[model samples]
Target: ALQRTPLQHEQSDILEQQARDEKVALEKATDQGQYFVFCDTAPLLTAVYSDFVFGDTSLYPRARELHARYAMTLILEPDLPWVADGLQRDGAHVQKPIHLKIAQELRGMGSLHYRVTGSGEARLACARAAVLAGNTHIAATGWRRTI
Candidate 1:
């Protein structure tokens, strides 16, 4: 025997429609651009957060689908030590699982590139190196830079 979850109400349908429309716009822009556009959040992570932690799943499917359309994904490693900043944090314990889920989902998407570890200039240099490496890869593959 099987059970089924009830269909989502009108709000979820509206949100899914909005996400689809936005993804179409972004895809149009991305196709028109020369160099690549870099983004911090891959959007699917937001979907994951919404589904698992944030008590909302309305936009998850659309967001996850659009994120899979991205050319590449860079995931910053989360091995750095943390201090409670007294603001803007849910503590590392809460965040670590979310971070791991992001990594897992990104891996499932098959485009993840993990950033090198360390802090300050070391991390900065790692980021720069990743971009440079991406550029080199593009050149080697005969792709044009967008930015």
Candidate 2:
């Protein structure tokens, strides 16, 4: 809706709503006993955007809480050519900066994240490898039963 609507990306109300939606979806996935719930971007990313665009940190606490529920986070690098995503994206130039901000935030939160980088099938392979590696780490650390 942010893409089609006139509402600005920095709008707090919309940001809050997006965070709430993410929380609800994550909760519902958990409630449904899903073994693996793949999220394109979580509330953590929403918090990143809130801070990056609006200088708002209001969503951090809740975003961090929801972030802890994830077994691992895959930070996909913006190495590929930018495809126009309507009004949702701020173009290719900002991709690296935004990605860095997200990495910094994840580090601050002490979250487990892997940077997935490559192109085409190689990128997918990298992500799959990361998932398998993360799963191994989770199992070894006895975090397997929780997810």
Cα distance off (Å), candidate 1, residue 107: 1.2
lDDT of 2 by residue, 1-147 (tens): 655423334555554565566566767877898656677767777777777766778877877876776788999998888998776776777788889988998898888789899998999999999999988888888874332
lDDT of 2: 0.76
Q: What is the lDDT of residue 144 in candidate 2?
A: 46
lDDT of each: 0.61, 0.76
- Tens-digit lDDT string for candidate 1 (19-105): 566566667767897345566445565566555555676666676676655555666777788687654355677567777777777
**How displaced is residue 4 in candidate 2, in Å?**
4.6
Q: How many residue pairs clash in all the candidates, one count each?
A: 5, 0
Q: List the residue pairs that clash in candidate 1.
A: 34-145, 34-146, 35-145, 35-146, 35-147
